[model samples]
Target chain A: MRFPLFLSALFLLLLPLTAGAQTKSINQFYRKYKHSEEVFNITVPGWLIKLGAGIAKSQAETPEERAAFQMVKKFKKLKFMVMEDHNLVTPRDYNRLISGVQSESFEELLSVRSDGARINFYIRDKQETIKNMLILVHEADSFIMVSAKTKLKLEEIADLVNQALDGDLDNEEIVPVIKPQA
Target chain B: MKTFKILLALLFVAVGFTAQAQDDAISKYFNKYLDDDRFTVVYISPKMFQLFDKMDLNLDDEEAEAIMSVVKDMRSLRILVSEETPKQFFDEAKKAFNTNSYEVLMTVRDKGGDNVEFFIKDDGGTVINELLLLVGGEDEFVLMSFVGNIDLNNISKLTEAFEGDGDDANDD
Candidate 1:
């Protein structure tokens, strides 16, 4: 009787932890296709990202470069997956993947479809800080998914976009500066 | 134990019904075309708007301030657009939404057979809850819904801000 009682107590204790660690649907989708020959996947750790950010900050010569450095520093991890073959992901599967992502507490930030290409941005946030961001780009012949884990405040991103729109930050100038050095 | 199980089952049923009822009409219309490849959908949640309200944007410019004031009260924005069979889609959208609850704010028809209409939902006061915009032309259809406590005065100020920026650009 005491053993049964202890087992019940143990189950109660571990239940919440297991639930908390449950894999998100987006991650599950990534794992399913990441190893396929048609898919290209890359995962960068937080430490490497920080190291690169520090290096870029040191080399920053322009205001655009400085702004890019500040934005890049907020990212903790990044996962990129791309597939060029249209035969790999069926339309039904794509729809299911989208539904699954939405069910996982991810909210749509923006979506655009034009000239046979569709781009979607989704973010998961807690209060005023964004926790995770996912970008999905689907074209006639290719699909790309980019996921980032960050603790960025929402205002920072808005301010950056505002600056970019106001012609204060030139995106072309920022791109080369943030590129990782060999 | 049997009675407890019955009660749990009933509770689940009640919760399911409540969830179904809570889905708004605009969401239902959006979901209808979500899986269709021809349509593009955009959604911004209330949480995002709440976050925007919390943001301390240090812009001292009047234009930026005006835009921020209008943005802070917005709860959600949903947009659906399609280029395939746009006229048909536009007509279907008109039929799908019950317009009796909304007041027609503006309607513009250009010489090119393009139609643009604006509708607002309010509680007989200056505060608006939802603003719906529909555009249908020969090649494109667009339906946009902005939901929140919207002030017409603030929106007019935003337009003025845009006009001011345009004038500045022209001067430069």
Candidate 2:
């Protein structure tokens, strides 16, 4: 009986440590993807994609409309809309993706837990420079940020993002992602 | 036969004159406020108006005229964009996008007049993303996009509604 009781006590003690350690692990994992080479067209949540696709289809029929319709079709087919719950996106990140980098594609896999969420925000910059990027956030006990850049090669872009995420930011509070001033 | 032809020509001329008059009235109000450099808070001239007309963002006759007028009155706007190619701007947006998606930057759209927008290309380019403006009374005067399905005809009607019934809009 004492053995079982002692085991239960130990398990409770270890649980908090695991939770704390998991948060750090998530940050580390996201940092790896930040430096990743492939452009990620991060879109998840089917509702948003459906709305975007409906609008795209309407414009595609208009001859005067620019290539915007075709671009939406391409995004619809990509992995931008895969949600895994842990990956939470921030508004600032969304603005960055649309207004900032002009890239071929962007995607994110969302994963969420009680602590926060994690997103594998990815982009594919097929051009000469790494042009596409996704800003990602994991908000829970702390807010984790992922600044992503993409290249032709997914592996190469992922590496670059990983290097960027390697900076030693003290995980104290949620820092507001500072977007480029308009 | 010659009399009939002359009468038809006169009717056509009358129509043309009436159309011109209507256009002139709206323009008169637009010009009145645009040059004030108070409501819009800027100082603009007719020369700059020609270039702003080319940007794809649709504006009705009144919205365009009103925006031009407001631009003329703005006091707190200056162009901060680097004159560069599309490629360079894309690259800059990308770097900023990766870090913060809504990174605000200015793009030089025309040689004269400040033509800028708040944009982010995130939706895989599905929709033309933009919030075109400067910081002043005239800042939100022009919405630099038509993607929201905003109708120019409706905009004109709305403009007249807000600014008071333009004679043409008042018609049955």
Candidate 3:
């Protein structure tokens, strides 16, 4: 009886690990290069972000600034890494990093390549909330990666922008209304 | 127990094959060049479209509304671009997919020796399953696949919206 109980306990303990094993996050890439001399990385926590947002909100003068603050406040965490030395990251590693993030369910939102420079945007969302947003920019001399975690929906941000653009931040009547296209 | 394990392995193999069989021709071609250093590739999956549907887009203007209507139906978008030997890649892409399976929507040849072609896979109706655009120029090659339940009418609306927006901006 004790042996069976032990087996069940072990299975329960290992179950969560197995569930998480499938996710290949950008954090793994960050952690790998964070210690490199040529790489610059910073991770801002949720509280710090909220504090910064508060300051920005207080200083905001225009509706656009307030709208930007509202959007920034929704982010739970932000991470950024940039490598100024092109030799630090190989082409193979960069490709692998892109593939790895895709494996983590990050869907490409936009990718633009021009004049030997490329910029890629990816987002991972669950239901109505965006869970993560990633941006990777590759140029001749440098590479940059930024990852943001949030529980905000794209429409919420869009609504904020729309309100700002309309110069009616207090107007709640401008909320999104879905009507069948005719 | 050994027999059960063997049966489970066979089941996994069968599942893998089924998934592979369902992949579209464009996707297969995209995957082939995905790891190539010369090309820049982008792929948006179906799950993103599901999320887009859930969003309450602020359709305050006619143009925004038209764009949102078309965006909601998009299942996936793939783009492959290269500046090196662009014409070669364009020719290779043309041969990779069966042209007979798609309807040629439009073809344009510019003064700069650039070629642009639009192909659509339809269900014998107004609904398009996939819209493929190929651009081959002296300095750039672009292959884009927009997969979705695209309505022909909405595409015209989208084009109109873009044209309306373009009028306010400088082209040169």
Best by TM-score: 1
lDDT of 2 by residue, A1-182 (tens): 99999999999999854532222322333444444433233424434555776686675653323233333333322222222333343545544443332222332221111212333243333333333334344443233343332223334333333333332122324556779999
State the lDDT of candidate 3 residue by residue for A1-182, as single tens digits: 99999999999999755533333557667777789988888999989999999899999998678878878899998988888866366667777888988877677777665556668788876666777888989887888988888878778876775676466535646767679999
TM-score, one value per model: 0.75, 0.21, 0.73
Off by over 4 Å in 3: A1-27, A91-120, A138-140, A164-182, B1-23, B45-47, B110-112, B137-139, B159-172
DockQ of candidates 1 onward, in order?
Answer: 0.33, 0.01, 0.24
CA shift at B5, candidate 2, in angstroms?
A: 84
Report chain B TM per candidate.
0.81, 0.26, 0.80
Mind giving the per-residue lDDT tens digits that candidate 2 earns over B1-172? 9999999999999999976664343233334433232222122223223223322332334444555444332222212122224334334333432333233545554544334445432244333222223221222232121112223345455576556645544672
Residue A119 of model 1, lDDT score? 81
Predicted candidate 3 versus true structure: per-residue lDDT over B89-151, tens digit per residue: 888877765456677889899999999988888879989988999999999999999999999
Least well predicted 10-residue stretch by lDDT in candidate 1 chain A: A168-177
Clashing pairs in 1: none
Residue pairs in clash, model 3:
none
Q: Residue B102 lDDT in model 3?
A: 70
